[model samples]
Target: MLDATTITAPIFIEDMEVGLTRHLEKIISDHDISLFAEVSEDRNPVHLNDEYAESTMFGGRIAHGMLTAALISAVIGEQLPGHGTVYLRQSMAFLAPVRPGDLVRAEVEVKSIDLRRSRVTLDTRCLVDETRVLHGEALVLAPSRG
Candidate 1:
């Protein structure tokens, strides 16, 4: 098991700055949608059924919004304040639907930092081409130097 006390955060709180940004990209695939549906138990037809989805407002099956949002989490944990950071809360707004095969780009920017509390707030977003599919803010406890 990993020990939190001994493990140092990849980027310490003192090193972070406003406007620091990182991006990650992935193509939403049929396999991804299916696995996410299975893992989340969100068998919504709009995400899994073709004909049924065609009857809806979107007119096509789409990837689960949370699946796209997961990319934002990836950018945070693997990129920006990477590794040892701890997520406190996330507020998301789903702006558009992401269809399978869409190339999703997740971006995160450090908006504010509270070094005294070892916390940081970031602006998070996911885009498909020029369209924003999801946007949000995330609060996390950053790793410390000491």
Candidate 2:
């Protein structure tokens, strides 16, 4: 049996030297699309209307910006941060369109650590093949005994 507390131990800068990588492949299920539409209430034709999307620059429906942003959360929450890590801040740039069938892989690396403050800087990116769909930096508060 896996102990939740042990699994959630705070990861320090040195601890992250081993590095972490994760790959995600999704077919952009209808449920994910519909949920994004409902929550954001952004009826952007490019994201909601197939006909409108067909005429747009994308030539087809594309996922919302926030939907793509969620990929970052997955990287931190499930991978780097793991269970008990707390998010501090994030900065991101969207570079490419994410279509319904596109497969996005998010990569995160610990760039720097402020041990005194118990904070870490992470380099994050979401990509499809060699093209980056999203790029950003994330700051997280690492748990410490201090």
Candidate 3:
């Protein structure tokens, strides 16, 4: 957990100019996949059976799109515009498949800010190497000074 006291300076319009970057290297663990599968109840063979996955066009087990999208939440909750940030909406497009061993990274840039309204617009994307796996825009309510 981050120390709030360390963040002594008030977040302002100028602070929005700084974008945050993160590299997520943990391979999607089997336990994580199993939990997601049970929760979503999506027993797609490509996700569950390695033998079946080898027969598919993807040629291997692929992670769920929603699972990849969840990285966006981590970026918001743990990284930039963190803690007090409230999500207004998110629009995303999945461009490629994500296999278990592939490392996915989420990058977010503050596109616009409405200080009076306490809203911020972010351009977000998840990528594997140079190939984009998912891209989107997120609208979030920035914390207001009381």
TM-score of the candidate numbered 1? 0.93
Over 18-131, each residue of candidate 3 has an lDDT whose tens digit, in order, gives 354433444576676778899999889888899999999999889988888888876775566776778899999999998887878877778888887888888889988889
Full-model lDDT for every candidate: 0.91, 0.75, 0.77
For each candidate in turn, the TM-score is 0.93, 0.83, 0.83
* Model 2 per-residue lDDT tens digits across residues 64-118: 8788888777667665755566898999999998888777777878777777777
Per-residue lDDT for 1-146 in model 1, tens only?
A: 12335543477888889999989889999999999999999999999999999999999999999999999988788777988889999999999999999999999999999988999999999999999999999999988887
Between candidates 1 and 2, name the one with more favorable TM-score: 1
**Which pairs of residues collide in model 2?**
none
Instruction: State the weakest 10-residue window (summed lDDT) of model 3.
Output: 1-10
**Order by TM-score, highest first:** 1, 2, 3
Misplaced by over 4 Å in model 2 are 1-14, 18-25
